[model samples]
Target: MHIHPLITDSESLKSLCDRLAQSDFVAVDTEFMRENSYWPELCLIQIGNREEAAAVDPKADGIDLTPLLDLMVDNEDVLKVFHAGGQDIEIVYNLTGKTPHPLFDTQIAAMALGLGEQVGYSNLVESLVGKTLDKGARFTDWARRPLDKRQIDYAIGDVTHLATLFPKMLERLRRTGRGDWLDEEMERLADPSNYENEADLAWKRVRISSRKADVLGRLKALAAWRENEAKAKNLPRGRIMKDETLADVASHPPAGQEGLARVRGLSPAWGGNDIGGRLMAALAAAKPLPADEMPGREERGPGLGKEGALVADLLKLLLKIRAREGNVAARLIAKSEELEMLAAGRREGLSILTGWRFDEFGRDALDLVEGRLAFAVKGGKLMMTRTEHSQ
Candidate 1:
């Protein structure tokens, strides 16, 4: 096993970045702490190509990451590979205001290859490289200084296995002529807009059971306020106000400062402070929503009348068949919610109705729903046949 170098200084990091810039693709991973903070605190970054791997200590003093960030943005020829890369890319974007382009995500690729949906890096590495990763250091405090050899090795192993896994997965995609499928997935991943933490959009993250416009309006205001506070104070949103408390406050809004004090989970200090005043002002400022603009109950898909449940069950079976035949994961093709939507004849805005998904299983799903396709047991295998009515 080659011992991966630890780059802790500017000169070494620049040298490594220069070498990596020449590679066709680089596998990247990050270790960060975010349990107590609003933003992830990047502690370590592991990067590798076909030839070499290294762990860069982002916490090292006077170590500038500009060279690395520049290389990532400028080297359009070199592809960046990551497994479940959303958070890793977010950290990079937060630090440098740049998202790595021309990226490949192994977890997404695995789904396209039928390895299963949202496959973990360890599982993918084990399946592809026949090596079980040591996960003991996975939960370690990465912010602590003087990382042990075991910890370093664990970090290095992430990108090392990725370097090996990317080629094999890429080859599988090319051979199967499913490379375009990955391109779509990668495009979504590479988009910087996906990682932006816009405060106004933060309301979407809060779960509110009530669809009443008044309740939703209050919840939206409170969530947006909390998001702004958390970002400004550098604290977790839950630390500012718990989700349950936020929901409760939205459900039964306080009439005044005194009533605000009565809300559960709201601290006495906060209720009496400027935050409470702001909450009151937000509620006061909320205008009555138009009937059409009112929030509606969560759409579980159109109401399935009699026999709707049975059709949904059959759709599940069809999904499995299509997944197996197409060598792709069923969940990737259409989730249960999407299956119900298809059964209910609501195709607009559904992912299965578009792109590679449409080609893979959407057409047959529509056919099955419309009675244009039928399933038959032929030699113990379930076979799909066009219905006599269609013929």
Candidate 2:
């Protein structure tokens, strides 16, 4: 495959994208820095097809990325391929307010193919294509300007390996008849809601130590306040306030803005700061969280009794056995929480009992939990067998 020189001009990038538009799929990768900011700083983007590849400089002066961006989000004929590309898609969404359509994530597909859960790019490449990648430039500061040949080579290497492996992987999926299994997952990766940062709902992401109505209300207000502040300042949410500190503040009310200095995570300067006053206002306005909206209720599952707990454990064992027998990732079949729900006799809304999941492992899970399936030994290996009670 021919690697084009670093793309820094619109015409060159446009031409590259136009040629790639005719291809069946495009393998893409991005290099960005997100350590100090809420938004990732996109520095380099490597895009490729089987015949060619190029590294586009996203930070190049006076260069517009609309052409490349259009290909990712607008073009429907070509599939956008990536390995563990959740962050990559997030970067694109940050820039364009849309994720790439007709998407495919090799890492997610690997789960169905039995490669493993959350498979890293290096491992996937090595496993599928048998090519070992150089790890030297893995930590390079992509934000640095005038990238060297070594850096460019390492960056471009990512898409090149992906471009090579996709066809072979697709073929294997076809042969095994598991290609359709990835359809729902791919659609999920393309959903725009996954990339949105709705501030009102941000508190859910923070770990909580209290379930009290007032505490939850304050936490909800504080988390929304922090999200707005982080977005305005272009800083990380943790830089504004850490999760533990947020939870602590919600649990313990200060007398006023002057009391902010006594807060463990806040600096003494906060005692008299405007932001400290903002926190006080948020706390003052907080109301008890409505019972209807409260989280951690028993109805959300996870309330298995001792006997139900034993059945959940047996269901997990059956999951392992089925995943091994089918050569698929256990998580792709059912989650631990879902098993507990099944064991607890709450089957109406469970995802494990629906669609492909039900066909894959949920059927046997239902049988096992309902006492129609049992574990047995055959030739010194643990295996699943139906009890006489099963039809």
TM-score of each: 0.93, 0.97
What lDDT would each prediction earn against the true structure? 0.85, 0.91
Clashes of each: 0, 0
Residue 214, candidate 2: Cα error in Å is: 1.7
Name the best candidate (by TM-score). Answer: 2
Q: How many angstroms is residue 166 displaced in model 1 relative to the true structure, after the best TM-score fit?
A: 0.9
Residue 257 in candidate 1 has what lDDT? 74
The digit string of per-residue lDDT tens for model 2 on 123-197 reads 989988999999899999989888999999999999999999889889989999999888988998889999999
> By summed lDDT, which 10 consecutive residues of candidate 1 come out lowest?
293-302
Residue 373's lDDT within candidate 2 is: 84
For model 1, give the RMSD to the true fold: 2.2
Identify the candidate with maximal lDDT. Answer: 2
